[model samples]
Target: MEPDDMLQTVDSVSFDRLVLEDSGRMAVEFMSYGCGYCRTIEPIVQRVASMIAAEETVLRVNIAADPELAKRYEITGTPTFVMFLNGSEVGRTEGPAPTQSAVIDAITRPFMS
Candidate 1:
């Protein structure tokens, strides 16, 4: 599926359902409209998500749009990445990811077990 189709908006209420009940792997990209780093990493996130199969999903949450989620996660900056497996956060990275390989590595590392 396309990255656009794979992306989901995560909020306080829907967060549990999207990350937990499904028990599916997810990559959450936390970003803001005004963040240059977020914009720069957007395409890399999309490409990595697209390269992955249907079983895995990459979700984009706008910190500007969802301040509640940002506060909940203690997100102080843009371009933060969180990987979830079975509804719990497994790994996270802050700032520009640099490349799709770094994203792919973060997303799949926990599953390597």
Candidate 2:
């Protein structure tokens, strides 16, 4: 997939339908515009997105723009990666990941099978 198409940005109104209601596995990065880590890890996230299967989705939620999503996800920090399976959260990494493999291992490895 194209780099731009790798991570789709989502908001509270669309979050429920796009992430929560989706039947397959979905990974969401809860981030904020002002977060340096969010920006730093963006490339890694995109790379991870490219490595995932077509059935899985990668998304981003800007906490600064949509505080409700942050609150609902109990996001305490920016760049929190949450993975959902069948509309329910299965795993999460609540900080910046150093590498693409780390991001994948933390959030997607378990669900890959």
Which candidate tops TM-score? Answer: 2
Per-residue CA lDDT of model 2 for 1-113, tens digit only, reads 23466788999889989988899999898987688988788788878788885767889898999998899889999888898998989888888456877887876764865
In candidate 2, the residue pairs with backbone N, CA or C atoms under 3 Å apart (3 or more residues apart, or in different chains) clash, namely none
Alpha carbon deviation, residue 111, candidate 2 (Å): 1.6
Report the error of model 2 at residue 105, Å. 0.8
Instruction: Give residue 31's error in model 2 in angstroms.
Output: 0.6
Across 18-104, the per-residue lDDT of candidate 1 in tens digits comes to 876768888788888698887687777777777886768888788887888888788888788777888788877787466878778
Give the C-alpha lDDT of model 1.
0.77
Query: How close is every model to the real structure, measured as TM-score?
Result: 0.83, 0.89
Candidate 2 off by > 4 Å: 1-5, 110-113
- Rate residue 42 of model 2 by lDDT: 78
Tell me the TM-score of model 2: 0.89
